[model samples]
Target: MAGNVTVDRTIVRAVTVFAMLNLLVTLNNTPSRSWMYPAGLGALGCVLLTLSVLASLRDCFRPVPTWRGIRVLTYISLGLMAAHCLTVRDLSPRDYPPLLHACGVIILTAAAAFPLPTGCVLMGTYAVGFFFVRLQSLTVGQALTECLVLLVSGATGLLLVALVRRTVSIVSTRSDLTQQEARATARALAQARERARWDGLVHDKILGALRNAAAGDSRRQASNAQTLAREALAAFRADTHSDAPTALARKLEQVADALGLECEIDIKQDQISSEVLDVLEAAAVEALTNVARHAGTPRVSVRAVIGQAAALLIISDRGRGFESQAPGQRAGLKTMKARMEAIGGQLDVRSTIGAGTAVTLSWSHEQPSWLTVLWDVRVFAPMIAIGAVDVILNVGLGLTRPARLFIPWLNPVLAAVVIGFNIAIAVCPRRPRLGWMLAACCVPLPAVSVLNLVTYGDAGWRYWAAGALTPAVGALSFRFRSSLGVSCCVASLLVLMVSEAILGRTSWAPVLGPFPVSLGVALVGGMLRRGLDGATAALSCENVRLAEQVRQAAGIAERNAEISRRRTALALDILPMLELIAGQGPLSVSEATECRLLEAAARDNLVAATLVNDAIAASARAARGRGAEVVFRCADNAQPHAGLRIFRSLVEQICATIGAGSSARFVWNGSGRDFIGTAVVLGHEASAIRAVVESVAHSGLLTVTCDEDSVLIQMRTH
Candidate 1:
């Protein structure tokens, strides 16, 4: 797609070169013309051929060819070939002039350069005119045979160009699909990483401090609680600038001191971005906090190693460890894993009971594979089809008049060898050197064998296989380099000329008839390869650029969302509670318990605000009052904003089904097309909830599962 214009220009230039060669060959054989036409008419024919070549040259450089120019060139080329045949005077029926060979060049040029309808019209006009013109000099059967040869040439040209265009379109479509999938994957990962960061910040920093302060008992404990409150406030106000680089060792030391733990820190390399460093630091802090709370230890080790294009961080603690698959501990570990994965990193956690725990985070720059962008089967399929067609047509034509062959048995054998070599070329397109060798061995064998086997008397028709098979040399163009393909074409032309000279032919028209067509085909193939290569490179670079931009925008959006949520919590929850505590000196036992409940409610809102609408909130409050624990966990920010009316009704139904002394945990997971929400209920046997979940499932919007002690309801997020 990127180099379409370049490919078009390459095709036009090939056609122009073919026209020039045809014109030159026609002029070279003019003195040997057996027909007695006027000298002035011959000069006019020459002028038309020159004008057509010049017009083709002009079309080569322009983006779109002038339709009028194409029409004029077509008329002149077809008119000259017909005029040469019609104006014959005192010439033998079998002694056709050389100018008639120009018809093949004209038909091919029309097919390659003209629009489809116009090209078909021009080709049809040439076919009818040539048939009638040949009737003036030869019998109907011979005239029809020549007309068939000319038409086959045109059809082959048209099919080749059509296949090329179809393959280009397919490649473009595939490239677009690949880019779309890459962008979608990137966006999903970005959203997951942002969710992980926010979930950890809210759960570990804000909610943990609020719970501690509300449960404080002694005077020293209250002072410590107040300190935690101030620290939480400072965290809400803290902002990170990610446009600069960060030193890993210094950050880890500060994290260890803030947690009041003895930490052994080691740093090997420090060339990392601020964004990546932030993820590493947050993961390290979470690991250290886990050690302090669950590991029953105060000392830990933090190590970071950064390379030219990759980084790794490891946090280890020797304490009272637990099984890695413990149920309640997975939430924090899952958050850290998602955080690492969002930045194309991996997180590995290992622990043994009464031993230790180790968490490793690693990331690196990855490059896309070149094989995906370069080689395609679509391009090869067309080439193989065209090559097979060429072999079939030539073989069919050669067998048409077996009696005319000097040695019919030997001819088919040689033709088979040539076909086999062509097949070799088709199959070994990636191995150009080997293909060129096979092409060299095949080119001269066909030209010499076909020309020598068939007796030449009627203007080269008996040996038409020699010229018709010339396009087979062009098949090498798809496999070999451009220069090598052109050389093969030239070699085939030389072999044809030498074989024709051995047959005592004085004119060069028959020898040069199909050479220009073969050369043009080779040029088109070379241009196609170059165009696709350029397009692939451009697409790869663009994908890299787009991924970087998406990551940056995702980071900015994540920061902005976090800031907004923090501001809301400060103004409506934390700040008001702090003011009340300050005004009253200290909270009573009942007030502290109320504060804990309020903090838990705020935490639930931060987790899944979309799921906790006014109706759902009221229902959840009533369930809580009935001694039920209602929790919400959202993995990503895929809120069903457009389907809120439906979501609210469904959520309210599920909430009402919750009985006393029960527990419900609602979780939102996935993003984009696969987004879903599920609610797990335990500790109660409720037939009403099963009925409600099954009713929604029957409508195709939800899926319900029930166990002896629990029920799960899942629904798509819009």
Candidate 2:
């Protein structure tokens, strides 16, 4: 949608540039006209055109007021140009001044800036007036031909704008979809990490304390167990409240002190998400923990740097470092890597034995490349197609009047050269260096061709080379740099002016009449390139802002979910057990053991809460009764509701294969476009589980595989 706005702005600016150039050329040729029957009316028309051009240029960059007044001025200017044509007298139409040339520019401007119905009405009105005016001075066949050319030019402009709008719409839709997908993925990962943290809390704190109280015998041991349970309950309740935001430097200092190490810290602050800060603090703590326990040295440092759309954090230590291949010795490091990747950040660990270790975490907003956007096919194709049509029309008109050429053989040779250069310009967007070189070589051809092809003072389309071939030079030059493009246009204009003066036509009409069209083409091309650059920058910044908002929202949602889960566990399981212990003296050995088992079962529900149904829970209970260990692990918590029904069916099939004295672990992971469920069972043949899994037919959305000790089932989600 932003891109569509950019396109619309570019079209408006382009129309303004072309309209001003046309008006300048018309003003230069007006006073020297020897064909106008009434001079006063012609001067009045010229003044009106001048005022309209000035108004359009003044408001080119502003978007308010909708440019309606400028459009009205342009319509009056077009009518005046047509009226000037109608006032011509005592001159054959073929020998008349090129008054209809201004009509082409006006038609293109209207078509680009106005809606279809209005643009068509304007073009039709101008075309009918021009056709009727020409009919008074020439045959009907010639008049019809000129009218057809005017209409085709207008149609070309309409088609070009339509194509640009369609392309912009497609790009905007895809960009929205991409942002939505990124947000979805970030939310899923945040939920998964939150759930994992809760699982660890339940197992290490609540469940461990329950098991200890069950096995204690003496009064002192029971007292210690009771103290531990009270501490665990307090910590569980405290975790439900959210953490207040803190500065990165303060957080790093806290982590380092907790791990019993002194860290030299350097940080530059910017607007960073709490989610990102949490990951950085966690990674720093893990790295410092390694230094305290295994690095055998206390020399460590932490550095953080924030930029416009990026961030970097590094944790370094001068200790006895281990080999890179043995990074898995610290499982926390792998976990930090996954956490960083979940938020679209990068983690790199560098180390050498007997040297030191440096862990780097970095993130940056993704941006589109300038070269790729500049050379987009949607923009380039239309320019090339329009240039080819210009060449065809110019060469066809030149060939039809062979007697007008001073050297008859030069027409075909010039045509061949122009066509070859047009082809060369088509590929210049890809290889700009070559394009500029070609542009430089052709800068002098327009002036040289005009000098050699026509006799002195001949005025019958003798400057066709400057009109036709010089535009290719303008097109190719603008693809590189702005200074070079302006230089090329001015150089050609001056050389053609000098050539016209040498040919004894000292008036500005010969130089200013045909060459402004080429100049207009160059300026429009440069404007388009600049507009694209601005659009790319805006799109990149918008994406970064949207990503930050999504991450912040996900962090808040995960916190709320954790609070709800903790409340449920406290109300249903832990509170009743504490009440029983308070009423009686203490839990008996059998009752304590039963309480520990129930807590362990509740821990399972905390880990894979979404996968728990009555049938699955009943099967797990039966398996535990038969002296089997059953565990459920879910690394991705955002599962689609539609997939849950199918996941339940497939899970039921796997549970049927579990037998006595067998340990089973079921893992659910979501990555990219697929949802994978893995079942690892020991003390049972894998082929039986695989066969059972495959028996449930799925319509190409599910696949099952079995290795020596595991049966893996994968389902496609997108």
Candidate 3:
């Protein structure tokens, strides 16, 4: 609808503007007394054109427009303007410029089409309009000149319009390509995360169980079975959201709860983008999973904060930390660092053997400052400026013999010094140390420059000499361990050598003496002042380090204080579990609740025990309907002594509560140090625990053997 309206408006405006221009020409050319008719017609035409242009603009801006409507509108406007031009030719009150008017109308109409062919159509229509105007006004040479100007104007306008349209097309295409890339990357990340989840489950559960079974530890074997169920739960939770950011605290709780490990999280909602959150969450889970598998640590804390311009995330553990930077030992740390950088973050880590480890990730929002601007200026700009000066001075002074010999030796030495300084700073242990390193670096080049100046009596040698001494004197003010001394001596010696060399050689003595003396004196004097600044800079570095150490020490103390408080809170939680185990009196409600938790915490985990029980009961009842021999048994060897009673009670309660009429047998047995038993649920409820356990018994493993939900089994044997 809007497209149709815009087309109408453009047609109206084109007609109106063209008529007004034509009527003005007629009035100007005809007798002033009789111009009223032409002016009135022109006024009417202007109104029509204005209305049409507006309607056409409105139409083009919207999404829906019928192909028929577009064609009808375009041809109607073209035909109307063409008819108007033909009727007005040689008929108005004055000579009419019908050609220019018609061209303008055609150009506007062609624009209404809105695509590649728009420009070509517009050019062709304007050409016909131009021919009409030229046929009316100009004679011979004037007509030819007018024709050239019209051609230039038409081509220039269309070329500009074409360029603008194509540029927009290219930009839109690039934007679509970038969006596709992001989508592809997101899909790959999702697949990788899914695989990691399954791998983690297998490692914690099946592998651990098999390892324990081989190690001959009955406790670990039972523990691994429970661990398997817990890992399955964790994998399920992680798979819940393939792309959305999962809460760090929630994910840790699920996995830690499964492994019977305690997790503490301090994360804020506004700390980072959702993308960063997902990355951190995955890394945290993986780290905790490793701890559960190897560290033997019962608890860990994960803390995260959004600094002024960076996001800081820390995962700390009170486990056996390894030696810092030990070869091949800290692959996880490397992985964590890589993850941080992938999200435009930084990782700073501190750890100690036997104490603990803190993996801190700092993510910057802005680009690195050095990379953004300063590094280029500090390193490249100077080299460029120096190179330009060297090229000009060396070429100009090559005519002199001494300059040829001296500059070659001096240039290489200077180049070596600059390269070495850059390499040293880049490889330096600490970034701030670059200040002193750069200052120290300034001394050597100046010494080489001064040596060359003394050996060769070329004025061009003065360029290298002066350039070298400047950085040296400037570097000394940095106040790190008498930085000025080496450069100062070099400058002083150059001054002495120049005085001797110039006094002995009288040929170019007048030209070189003044410059060498002035530069040498100034350098020596500047070095004296910098010697003091160098001392201050050295002291400042030490002070800064000490201040930093104090700040860090305070942070550690504060964290330790917080840890102590959390430990106290954990102690309060564990108190109920302990009281229940003591059995001094009837357990309190809280104590009874904690007892379930304590039972779960005793081995790999009992958190998944409830789910395991549900699945077992469901599977067994289904299997026993076939009336095959079957038994649901609690294995005595699953856990020894104390824990054996808890597992037994749990199994017995499950059997009694899930009652179904079926004939089955229960057997009690002891294997080595383990109290084990088997309940055989037979007939219709053979796999069902209720039929097997007609009487109650307390043990760990509840194994149901049945065929198609129907079976028969031994009533007892222990």
Candidate 4:
């Protein structure tokens, strides 16, 4: 309630200033002795208002007004004003110039200090009393009109302070929520980078050696590569460093830029280990370097996708590609394979003689980070309620000395019973029914323990019920869900306590006395039932989440199997054809061209199976056939977000707008919180692409920027 305090200070300061000016007037009129009595009372009122200013200021200089003392001081100022109003018939004491106005300011200031309803009662009652009490000296107009103005002005002032307080409180709450969101975003990014780092480690060390061995023409060279790969895997975990996905993203971008390569980098998650990040970074650098060397025009695209338990990175180039098996040309690919093998990941390479090249790295971790779980805050509500009830019991114990003296053993026996149940609750690995049963057993403990104490003293039956019902109310409310039940339980508890005190030591009979207590206890039993239902609801929600996860996992597994089947079918088609061409003597020029085309298409199709979404992949293939160079990336989501409908539609429009030999880039879900639901599409014909969308009925908001040479289309869904 910082906002409340701030408004309070402003009110106090205003009243204080008025008091100071009033004090000056009081001082000027002091020396006249004829009207000493009224003059003396007026002086005291002014002095009291001034003292309120000091107390309010002192409260500010120290800490806060958590106690009732500061409130009492403000009321004292109000009281002196009421007394002065009773004594003096006019606005101020005979010669004192309008001290009542200053008193009015203090009264309103006091009103602001209290809650509105209570403050209105206090300030209005005093203001009305003053006006009517002084009616003997006041005109009818003065009594009615002047009193009305005073009440209205005071209420308006209070309203203004409350408005300021409420506005500040809302803004303060929103700022805290914003900060929490920002921190959560940062952690997600960090974890994503960690996962990427582990994948990278596999690429750099183990995969690299395997690639070299695969390219070897001799058994000796192949055997040496095997030895290196094995050694790298054996020492891989020991040699790995903490992954920095941010560093990796930055370095990859730098590598592309240094080579004058035109590229876009989209990394949505930084959830890989440091070692994996390092490996992936090295691999990305190597792939980009390869683009600079063999791929003409040096154009590349790098993207990283991180998920619940797995991650993938795709480094692609649309420049002129080379044959993978060409002498000394497969060095980078060999190393990538070795690194992937080293860290228990996989690397797949695809290159076409003139089509393009794409390097795909895929990995999954056995244990996902706990931060990845989406936990509900309400999961701890029951625990918080239980703990709060426990603390309240302890506090009430200290507050209760008379009850303890009545039955000296009452305190220790109840404490031991409660503590014993506490231990029982703690020892259970899971939330057990026994714990709820034990708590139910402990709820009536106060009345039951005091059975023997009834004869010891005359604190009355009210005293015993006081000990019982206070705890009964708290314990019942701990988990009670029904508003009606809680109200009834509380009402019954109050009635039982009062009735017990009335009965004194009279009769334990009279069914009415124990009737309400029984109803209250039954209502408390509903707490146990409510808790059980809540637990059941939580379990059901958890089951839904797990079921969804399982379904997604199964979909991914089936897709992986489908991809394996496609690769096998494609290999069966290409390998036999290549083997026939090689054995049937040196291939003719046309035969060699056919072999290269078959290989490139096969490789591209296989890479396409894993690295890109079908929609984007189909659009890319279509655009390529139309002679436009397009790079499409969508990372972080195995299934495209619903928000991407507008984005994908706009991207297709852009790809369609590109003239033959033109180029464009499409990026979705970039690295910042603001950019998460955003997609950027930029191209030389961007303006023409914007024109294509000018007549379309788009669902989300689109921002189109047409530069001199490039048109840019940005879509934001959230």
Candidate 5:
């Protein structure tokens, strides 16, 4: 808190020092006198300086509250400066009054404390005082320029305060999120442990009592039953509330105890954020659930390590693993991965059939610096090529000059060096110091410009304009930090600034004037760099997320096709007998009853075969409505935990394509290294079946084999 407060007051302190020092400068430079008064104007100036110094000292510890007399003192001080300005006997059109500088500083200091509107008042007050003095004592142009510059300085002071306040707010917000996450985690972990304990108690005590009562059922067991009943009540009474473990090991141990898994907590760091730990722990639970439920009762191992840079959690089990992209498994992976991403972490799963499945979850506060410099250079190659060409062309033009600058071949040598650096950086840019490439781009112009100014008395503005190349390059490479970009550009400009004095010029406006533009370029670079950082992170997250979705859709489509084939088979078995009875003559009561019974039984089979997929349901309804025999069987699918929802739309498409006489068979082959769903369709010609296979096979998931009698689609669920 103290540090944040100090940061907020930095601008105020700086403005105070600026104001006080400029007052001293005024005392040294001003020539005004007050002989008629008991004390001269110089003595009065000293008194005012002493007061300002005292006020500054008080303000160092904390800002002066508005209720205090600081505002009034400041007003009085400005009034005194104005009085001094008015007393000046000689004023030149070209010279500015020293008091104007003092007024500017005082206004700047005021801006740091006051709200915007109040700061405006302070600025206006100072400007009015200075204006009153300047109107009588100096030329109109001098007065206007002083007022404008002073106002601009005051606005800059306000901007400093605003920036500081914003920084403090942003820091506070992040801290709050971290703290809140910790509290939320504590509550959730406590609840989970409490629930686990209750469950463990019931399983151990109450269920054991019931089993004991059931086992001893003879008359000799009545006393044993009574004893069991009493024991159950006693156990329930004794299972009182206890504190849930929250420290890392105890918490994880409790989880392992409840879940019946082996747990290891490797604490590399003394402390970890609860927010990060919560995310990791939750993801581990999801992974372990998948392993136990799908991995054929394999032994589960859970491990967690909290490190300095990041935390890692691993859950492994040797189980009968299915394809990682199998819809059921993919859904769990996606859920866990999304949880990790929310906390800026990565979640990954690796599995091979009959070997094992391992789910790894990791999170870090800072992004890992994973720079592919070659890729970055590839992206910027065109810009670098253009810059290289410009330098070469400039050198070619400079070669036409009959008179040499510094050396006979200096221009071409500098150009060659610059172009070499540009090409080298473009092909293989280095990470962490990418900004330094600007120095190479800067060298050609400044070296040639300075050499020309030395060799010839007349130097063109074109020579100075060439110096801007460094900043332009810096702007283009804004994503790089100071070491690689902005600082190097500024260094090149500083060389030109020093060169102007070495060339023996009285004024170095040509060199010094461009410094502000350099700063502007750096500002632009910083902003662009910041924006791209955010965009890069968001793009990466979206890429993996989209890949998961695409894999999921493919899995769903394959499942739906397989379900439709099952529905068709079930419909074939019963449909024709009903059709015969409807078309032919009247039947006996037994025949009619038998037909109704068969129809009812067929309808029940179809309902039981209905898949839990939305798209497959709609498609099945449409196919049946079109006089197609659809059969559904529970045996046609396996891997109940797999996340595939059989949508009817895919089946409808196939039925419509195959026409009215089609009979399909779906064989669910999940007892293997990968899930195999094969659909065999009859009544479609070999050519049509071949075409359908060609269209869906492009996905690299399904294989189609067609013969004269039937077409088979084998989809390998990945």
Candidate 6:
């Protein structure tokens, strides 16, 4: 704020400096034979300069509210200079008071135009005083010329100041807008860099291990490793790449290739901006990901278009689709929907689990340039069309009271249709191109009206008044466009003329109706249309939000259900083995039933736990393996404990179920007899593996692998 004040003060000083310079130039141009006149003029210049400096300083500390007194003082100084210029007898008529008087007038004009409060008043008053001092020496012609020149100069200066102010405002606004765009671009670049780093590290380590396993003649191990490797690779690759805003279709193609899925892209290029590209990219990616993961289909098609002031993107997969409205079924789908909305776009999904899924994203480009033109045309087009139609119908039913009474209502209806047509064109899925053609049609309508007016005088006024309502009605109906505002202004002027004709001039009353009725009709129609349009837009936004919420809720529920099913299967397998063990006596030695139950329970529990662990490991490996290095190791610490031998048996069974090749072991010297601190290695597939390991780690006994097989981690009983 202080900086702004400082800058403002600098601007005022610059203006004062320019004003003083112009004053000096005026003094130099003024001719005076006597040295006294020149001397007096120089003194005035010095005094003006001194006053300007002091005013600038004072303005910085605190602004002066009034400049009346300062103005009077400057006027007194100019009066002395003017007197000197007037009384110089040695100078010629053109050189003496006339020329000098013109100079004084210019200086005074600059003062008035400068926007310097105290300075302008002082300069203006001084100019007036100077003129007053020379008043006795001037003739009537000279005085008139002085007044004329002063008026012209002041007007010119004022015009320049207004132009400067407008230019500054425009430049400042543009600068601020550019800065905001720059900041946004920087943020996007940062996100892209972070994704690239994540992908690079995940791919190098996890997939490489899978390749080695396959080459070493371990086919069974290779297949299992490959599945984990593929998951990791997919995550890494997906994380690394992003869709460029303007080339969404291209990005979809890249993603399809990476996933080894077939994809078709059909998109229009014209009028495509980053905003449109982003919406399409989001919709296409989500749809394609679902197809790859769940559709059980190989092919996807994407189509995009820009038309009729709207943009559309559609993605369809030939994979298994899901229930259209099942609760908790589609989180990915819901996400795609939310993205479309933020940009004022809409998304609709159609799917059946067996058939395939199709997703459509649509949005209007909402061009400001077009809106302005549409507004203008909307107001006048229907108005003129309705008027032309009105004239033809009115003439057909000439001088009939019924025709006159019904025509007003009919005129508005036809006008409304014209407006509806424009709105349809604006909101249509296809881009509208009637811009030039609309202009062409409007050109001759006014000429035809003028010809009718010339042919029939008072009768023409009635036709004119009726025709005026066309533009007025059109303006009210499609006032969303800028064209409507201009049309309204033009229509208002026309109505004013009509009002004058009907009420002020009784001569035209026979041909025209009352002023109040026309005015009221125009006002009410415009307001009504505006209200309806606003309500419609608000409702559309609300509906989209509600749909998104419903989709999200349904998706959450479905995921929860899938988790429950998996847990139930594991529980059923473990429950029977536990019951058999309980049936045996505590001290049963080598009992076959007890031994079989223990073995079976261990296998069942280990298999269930292993499946869960491997799935988690695979998911994490996939995440880290995307564009990065990964490693896996098995620990040699699988042993049964006396008290919890079931738990130890479970670990061994789990290791076998998940396969042994992906494990790592570490030896660490401990002060105690407990070997639980031994390190066991997981995978270098995904960074998420760290999270899985940490989650399962217990204080008494657990796997801990850190520092590249050098350190041991285990659960400590404290």
TM-score winner among the candidates?
2
Instruction: Put down candidate 4 lDDT per residue, 1-718, tens digits, no spaces.
Output: 2334434444444444434444444444444422534646756655665675566656544433332334655576567666655565443312322344455545654576667787788677767765765465556654554465445445544553454445445544544454455455544443433333333433433343433343444554445445444544444324334334465667777667756788888876656665456566677777886787778866688898855367799989887877776422243465565566554578888888878988898888754211211112243334334443433444343335344345666556665665554444334333334434544554454444445353444332323333233333333333333333345344444443544455474443222222332333234334333433333344444444554455345434443444444335434444344334323433445444444444333333322222334465556556655666665443333234555566566656665667666777665663334443333444466567667767543654666666656665665545
Global CA lDDT computed for model 5? 0.50
Candidate 1 backbone collisions, by pair: none
Each prediction's whole-model lDDT (CA): 0.65, 0.64, 0.43, 0.50, 0.50, 0.42
- Per-residue lDDT tens digits of candidate 2, residues 281-370? 666666776677677787788888965478899888888888897664334555566566755688889988778889998977655332
Cα error, candidate 3, residue 676 (Å):
52
Residue-level lDDT for 672 in candidate 3: 30
Model 4 scores worst on lDDT over the 10 consecutive residues at 368-377
Number of the predicted model whose lDDT against the real structure is largest: 1
Candidate 1, position 598, lDDT: 64
lDDT of 5 by residue, 359-404 (tens): 8888876643221112354444444444444444444434543454
TM-score of each: 0.66, 0.68, 0.36, 0.36, 0.41, 0.30
What's the lDDT for residue 155 in model 1?
63
Against the true structure, candidate 5 reaches a TM-score of: 0.41
For candidate 6, write residues 180-235 as lDDT tens digits.
Answer: 55355434443332322222222222322223232334443344334434544344
True-structure lDDT of candidate 3? 0.43
Best-to-worst TM-score order: 2, 1, 5, 4, 3, 6
* Least well predicted 10-residue stretch by lDDT in candidate 3: 368-377
